[model samples]
Target: MMKYSTSPTPSTSSYPRSTSPLPAPANYQPTTASAAVKRYKYLRRLFKFNQMDFEFAAWQMVYLFVAPQKVFRNFNYRKHTKSQFARDDPAFLVLLSVWLFLSSMFFALCIGLSSGQIALFVLFVVFVDFIGAGILVSTIFWYVSNKYLSVDGAGGDVEWGYAFDVHINAFFPPLSLLHCFQILLFHNLLSHSGFLACFVSNTFWLASIVYYLYITFLGYSNLPMIKNARAFLLPLPALFVLYVGTLLANWNLSHMLMDFYHYRVL
Candidate 1:
């Protein structure tokens, strides 16, 4: 006791002594820290992508880029990949079409073409937009088709078959409009007061989009096999409804424009 009092008390190491004696499971696997982390992260991603059973790596990469982060941020990616990916919602298409149509009309009338020549000019703008849409859609289809064929051994050509699915939503239409809008803005800046010129340009844009949608639909839908038959047919009913809706919307928008103009004058 006298000798111990002279020296400092010995400290215990970090390791703890367990009083309970529990046997370790016989088949317990010791996972490395890095491997465990990777597994956990993968599970989170899987849960986030909603376990979309994406077969091809190309689409997976596309999803990783295009997909909204909110869809996956809370989950483990690893756990979700065990299943198949589901198709996009049909309502999303309808909503996108409506929004695109409304936006196009507004931009064409207000900025691209003057409010005075709203009708014909808007139509023209829509036409040019469609043409550009065709090119863009075709390119996307080509890229996806090539990727899909390389991986899955399906889709004969990039022309009309599987390409229809590529343009099912208002994806191409809106994208093309965005591109045309930028160029048209530049044109508007250059020729500030030439309504007729702007109208003509806008007409070309609209006509191009209409033509592309029509031709592409006819080409893909009328194909020999059941290639895009399902996708094409699905849109027909929706387009009919959209056509009627667009007329009503355009009419209402026109009235609103007139009211605003009158109010400004008053």
Candidate 2:
């Protein structure tokens, strides 16, 4: 009547003026609720030995040293399928914890630590070096990467758990190199004051640091939303300079580390 045309009325279903928001997909949910659920589930299974997938964690450990980039590829797949980058299974953490314990024991023995000293040594390594430092580092990287390195309008956020995982991954090769392999050769080579000892020990330290940086780069670069992950490797040149400095100064890193640990425990 009032010059109405053939335009049809907008469907309420498609163009609602007011309605509840859509439900999240199965893999995606509100953050607080999802985090609470995940935490509860992860902790509940922590002591439940049978429920943890140790095999997968072992596989990750092997790949971490030999083919580290391949290890991160699985993280990408997990992000797609689980809608999160962090691991749900506690197996890797469990394996890492066990490794830290065993390696620390061997380290204490190699350093001629007494029973009480060994206890203190293991406690320092497991608690301060691994857990406390891990949390601090994880928080720092999580904040920095999300704040500065995340791509603009990338949408997804970096989880603290994922950051911790990266730390543990980077920590592994160094632990084995320093605690296990270095211990094997400590008395023979690394503890000596010879040039060959300086070169070899410093080289091992250099390699350990490089592994940490490279693994960290792989972890962050694997993320679809992260940019400039090459920033992780930026320290390599400085580390090399420091390595050469240590060699020239005849600073046996492993010997110094042994002395430091023994001093701490004493």
Task: Using lDDT, give the best candidate's number.
Answer: 2
What is the Å distance of residue 80 in model 1 from its true position? 10
Candidate 1 lDDT over residue span 72-182, tens digit each: 211111112211111222232333345556665665555435565566544543454444564576566556434433333432334331253335422444344443443
Candidate 2 lDDT by residue in tens digits, 1-266? 33432212222232212112234446664344376677788788898877666767887898789878767655655565566678878888999999999999998998899999999999999999999999999899999999999998877788888998999999999999988987888888777888999898888899898999999998988776788989999999899899889888888887788779978987
- What is the Å distance of residue 201 in model 2 from its true position? 0.9
lDDT, candidate 2, equals: 0.81
Give the 10-residue window scoring lowest on summed lDDT in candidate 2: 10-19
TM-score each candidate. Answer: 0.28, 0.87
Q: Which parts of model 2 are misplaced by more than 4 Å? A: 1-33
Candidate 1: segments with Cα more than 4 A from true spot:
1-88, 112-117, 121-149, 152-266
Candidate models: Cα lDDT each: 0.38, 0.81
**Residue-pair clashes per candidate, as listed?**
36, 0
Alpha carbon lDDT of residue 84, candidate 2?
Answer: 67
